[model samples]
Target: MAKSPMDTLQLSYIQIAIAFLLFAQAKSTTEHTSTPQPNDTNTACIASERSALLAFRAGLSDPANLLSSWKGDDCCGWKGVYCSNRTGHVVKLDLQGSGYTIDSDSRKVLAGNISSSLLGLQHLRYLDLSFNEFDKMQIPEFIGSLHKLRYLDLSMSMFIGRIPPQLGNLSNLQYLDLRSSYQDRDIHDGTYSTDIMWLSRLTSLEHLDMTYVDLSAIVHWLPVVNMLPTLKFLFLTSCQLRTSPESLQLSNLTSLETLFLVGNQFHQRSTPNWFWDLTSLKYLDISYNGFYGPFPDEIGNMTSMVELHLSANSLVGMMPSNMKNLCNLEVLYSYTSNINGSITELLHR
Candidate 1:
């Protein structure tokens, strides 16, 4: 049994077979571990969109290098750029100057032209260029083409000339801020709107701030504003407006919470009676308007009023007895006015 050559040969064959099988298994394991897998890095931005952003960057004078991260191929990873996860579409471009200092000689404001190349971002939903300096350039009519935009803030951005009616094309716009400086209202170099009939088309508008934009030319502005049923915050401060709330036959602003009409030239003899219908209004600032007459007893109807500012008006007489109905009143300012009211009684109520 110890000297059997056939048995030894068979044993050697078995060992060789097992060795080959082990080597094959090791090779398979090595191949499985070393194989390249799909890249899991965040989706890269589309090449065309990235090129559009680069073109947009080329137009702006970014003195603060605020756009330094914009160099890479993936614009989705760039500063102030946001992309949709599913489609990798650039959905937001927020280059607001508030993130930088504007008071110093080394102002961080981005100056220069806003390129129309931004139109390439067809899926962009939010765009903010507030607090930047544009050298009194007129807002580009091309911005209206960005129909997907839901938020647009261009406040204090030094944009001049007539507001383009093309903005009405933004049917999906929910928040719009075009607040400029009152000093910016020059006959030749101010942001003025001769025809704001386009505003009525923004039926989805919820918050609108057009402070200091000269709207004095639009005589029938009230009715157009009344068409917006979803408006929550309406700030038209110092707009040189002449339209009185009384002109509105029926107000549809049931959702209005904050209404700022300060520094306007409404010149009404009395507070408009239509104001009482804003029962849902939480903050109302109608100060500095040339309103001269007795304070309306309708103040009692504003039960939801939280802050009421009637400063610098010509309203006279004691507070209305019904003012006690404003149980939620938090702040009341009637300074520089002839409104003599017992504050203790009004507050205790």
Candidate 2:
């Protein structure tokens, strides 16, 4: 009985999407049991991509039969599909919901009609329909025409309208989750999207989640996500964004490492100093924000931070005793903050 913190951040986003479907089924079982050649053959899965995955299983609503191993002539041996053993084709299609039952008022979801026959796989590259139950459809802009997508998860899967700006043409995306909090939704429940400037052409983006997206009138959204020079894990939690950025020049973002701006608008947009130039931050979530004064000291210069969340902020005085230089600090979340320091010299440094 202890999973809050948004259910531990949605079970760490489904354990990083089941560890990316166990690394794409261990790279398709090490390319068919590695090191086995003798004119090796076994390339099946492409009868028009197994009839477009049996017309995407006659448009879902599977109520837990779990696609019954998707019956047929080798969809690369079905079951959450994954092909590509030297071009068998259909590359990864993890039907997330982890063996079913992701309660959206659980009638054991897997709801209907998301056809377009998945644009016929076309050498698909990892697509997770997160926690199935597409009742609030409309996210299917032909899935941005697939284009060799590199990991795309339709989070929570209740998908409603307006997200697809043709997904910025995929640009070989690197992990992009369109998060949704549902019911406690944003963009007035029509699900949001305000021209993410096509997410600055992806630029090989590395892990970006639009948490409860709304993007509050994206004014070039922090210079178009600082032109994503291979960004590393960034989640815009409850994005009604206003994370103060009249330029602190976050150039090339120093290969950022996990930064989630939780519940946005840092206390009327004040907590900005360009996040201490992101010294390779290691998991820093600005929790349920609206942060007000005093807790700043450039966050002890980030010293390779390890899990720090200023929970339910409105932060107050005394915490920056140079945070004992963080020194790889672990898990510090101040709930309903009014931070008053002296944690026994910060727990003996």
Candidate 3:
């Protein structure tokens, strides 16, 4: 049958409408399948990791109810626990306390055993239990088994006895802080490390702080510390370090920015120190030591120094003329009696 022009136009319109409907239907089907649906894998954490965390919490005495939220199967939802979004694996456990303060009540901090059950967390990378009470127990040797650990902080905790050498097994560790508080300094009951040879294994270390930890017995401590090429911030205040023999004349701390060696036993010595080679130093504090005699002219070499502390020492003699080269210097702290000559010449530089 021969159709008229009007009939043809109407047929074409019908065909276009049918094609549009078909396209819409196919698009809706793809959107339904391709869209992300609720999966139990993403919402629920790994079963084995959850059990490990529960066991870890069992050994702790949470006086402040810090672990009160540590209930239910989803351990990821618990306090101070973080899980990987993709794998649902536990990666970090941070239970840092407010530290033992004179004004705060004893019930405010966590006190008890750090369970060995933490070994079950194979993927764990970061662990921090600083500022808590551990009943003066030694650090567990089993902690060395966690090979994935990158950050470990036990500072200001009431741990006693020698620092476990097993901590050296953490080759990936970047930050290690074990600053402790002593119950009795006379008896040396606080954490002490006589043999720190294991420290050389931590090649990736960047920041190390061992304030208040007795390292006087370790005569070769300086050389072992120099092994860390990436170390930037080092704090060894009140560690009873000695300043004799001058084992290392030049430090390998190319990236070292801040150094604190206050309250050490560098007694009655005018010898040249090794740290003067660190021209990159921004902050240096060597106060409260037994250093005596003339201040070394080497101080002028550290032009990058911003703050220099030489207080509480027996240093004497005039300021070095080269000290005027410290253009970037901002703060200079020293005992006035330590300076003998006129400061007008150095100040004008």
Candidate 4:
């Protein structure tokens, strides 16, 4: 009375199904057990960031209520302190315009200075210290150590020192604003160098603002910016650029949309032929310079232009007849220039 082959096969199938179910259950249990519970990385990183902030606060004579709630017990909830939810790493620390007072009697405001402790923010990405007073402090070279930094704003901070070439090490940097910090008197020491060739290493930079920084000696440095193919918004107002290069070409910066060169000294020269080739340019300002020459007939090539400012220059020529081709142009400023052209046609369009 041997069991049929079909019955034996059925028994084996049931055994195999049970074994498979048990193995799946065991795997699920292991995964549940091995999953890492929330730990100290987040806590430690937050603490470190807070500690850096506290050090900065202590260094200041007065913090002007900007750091009122920056206590250690509940640092994660501190204002202007942003931490990663999962990893707890501090990523953003914005302390702009803190308005700290120096002395009780004199009540002189102590503008924020660059604290070396801020370099400890290993994961910091966005830092805005603009509109504060750095009191003639030099930008700390340690800032170059922030490998993960992407956006930095030190504009209007009153910092007086040579631009740190080490900033080129920030390969991930995308936005940089250092405008209006240095005054005309700051140039007496001749510390400013036109050797900004290190800026080419910041290939990721898209928006750059270096207005009013006394760049008269660095006319050659202007062309070097073309190396950054990713540059989109460029502001170089009042930089004392004395001339436009004959071979000035920026066709590679196809993504450029906004360009500001107001109050630069162009030495009364012909507009560079390459200027018409920027097909992506939307906003352009070249006002208050010495650009003297005929407007290029190919000016219409920049059909994407929406706003164009060329006022207060010594340009002498008939306006290009092709100017009517700029259908997208909304605002055009040619005042104070020797531009001769009938405006009736442009007004009609």
Candidate 5:
């Protein structure tokens, strides 16, 4: 049927409009398909993290059904597993309460020897192996290989022998807790250097807890720890430091927040002038020492201080008047001291 010119033009215009709409729809679909989906990538990474943990368990000969419940496709369902919601990478592994027993044949517990298998977890940041027995196990040198590790809690684990100097290789390590209630008291001579020069390598270390570690000669090297710029928390309880450093210079650690020297022999007379320079310190505890002196007047500079403990010392002086500036001060313990201060002032402030 031959149509008129007007009919033919109208038909051509309708076909052109339909073709344009179809082209637009196709372009939109292509863009939507090409765009990368971050959620899918994260899901895949999370699945990989879970598989790595499972592989780690499988590599160990667990005769005692220790990690039996760790089976499943969902990583979040497993115990002691924490995944970052944003990146879907495993961030924390708190396996402290898991019932992992020692193998009767090897006399070794699961996850005792830090192996390359565990080290394969590149995204892992926090690892808690406390309350587990890793007795006489030489810390895997590869543990220092974890570049992303930030917090490590090995406390209450029967880790014997001198600390591995290779641990200084963990540049990102911030918190290190190595306290053990039943730790070996026999200090292996020549096993570890009292100088601890290796500690200087951990530039990012902030909190260091070496409670009950044999530190007879380590007191002399305490000043060297001042080289760490980010160091804020220091715990040396029962370290056997006979006297505080004569210089007591830690001025570089401007970020220092907590200073604990409990159960040391740092007498009051040995306290140096630099002790007052810890302007950023918020918590200071030097109890169970033979310290005897007036609390430094510069205590007022620690305006951010919240807790202060100077108990079991021979401190003899009236509390400083500028102490009122410590608006955040909450807990102050000066018991067993010659400190003569009106309690009313502190209570009112």
Candidate 6:
């Protein structure tokens, strides 16, 4: 049909309107397709958390240049830092000091207050600040707030004062080591913990080492440790823990496998009756104490015992006759003690 001018104009306007709509729709579709995925956007370290880590580094004196990798914006890739794959949240920070003897130059050690900014890293699960020198500062109480922490090691660090009971707040903690080396004990002024009631809350704790920390005042140590059903390795060397364990307390430590009680104040050659009560012990060390009397017959019950050390004490009499049952025994140290009878048969066995 031959159209009028008005009809032609109307038809042209309709076509133009459709073309414009199509162009707009194509542009929108292109833009939508190019949009970044949520996971890609989350690949970068969270800005606030990165800042928090940088702030934490700022307070440290890094003479060794150990934290040089901490310059960039992406903290997940920083040295000694670990981030979650799903959320990119900082999960672990290990700033262990360079392996240096105490007598050597100590400049590599980190010293200063731990910045509160670390609290922003709410997902931190493992923190190890061992072998550093914090100038005898008390362990910060705020660290207890890191609820997700599973492993924490401050061993050989120069922290002094009562171990903050606040650490009990880490309910998920599985391994904790605050042990000081022989050098640390000599150079540092003092460190001790009088109360450990908070330990009762860490139901998941497995390995615990508090060697060289004075624990003489904690009368409930046995009872408190007994509550941890999952405990396996325990190191309490030179703790001066004088209290004896009660039968009730000994009954609960059924899972303990390795025990180190080296250099304590349990003054006698006679083995404490409770020593035999640890039926699951595979390793035992009670060296440099005042133990006396004959070798314990009750010790034969521990068929799983692998190492036995009873040196530098007053242990007397012949070795127990029933010790042949400890077929798993690998190492035995009975040097520097008083009179001891020979047992060639036990040795051959």
Ranking of candidates on TM-score, top first = 1, 3, 6, 4, 5, 2
In order of appearance, the predictions have TM-scores of 0.85, 0.33, 0.83, 0.80, 0.71, 0.83
lDDT of 3 by residue, 230-322 (tens): 887777888888854443666678888778887788785655767777888987877778888888788989999987878767888888888
In each prediction, how many residue pairs overlap at the backbone (N, C-alpha, C within less than 3 A)?
Answer: 0, 2, 0, 1, 2, 6
Evaluate model 2: give its TM-score: 0.33
Q: Which pairs of residues clash in candidate 5, taking residues 3 or more apart in a chain or in different chains?
A: 268-291, 268-292
Clashing pairs in 4: 268-290
Name the regions of candidate 3 deviating beyond 4 angstroms.
1-43, 244-250, 341-349
- Global CA lDDT computed for model 3: 0.77
Highest lDDT among the candidates is held by which one?
1
Worst 10 residues of 4 by lDDT: 30-39
Best by TM-score: 1
Residues 237-276, candidate 4: write the lDDT tens digits: 7777776656554356888877777777776565564555
* lDDT over C-alpha atoms for residue 214 of model 3: 88
Model 2 residue runs over 4 Å out of place are 1-45, 60-86, 92-124, 128-133, 136-150, 156-178, 181-210, 213-231, 239-255, 264-278, 281-295, 299-349
Q: Positional deviation of 35 in candidate 6, in angstroms?
A: 35
Any idea what lDDT model 2 has? 0.72
2 against 4, candidate with superior TM-score: 4
- Candidate with more favorable, higher TM-score: 3 or 4: 3
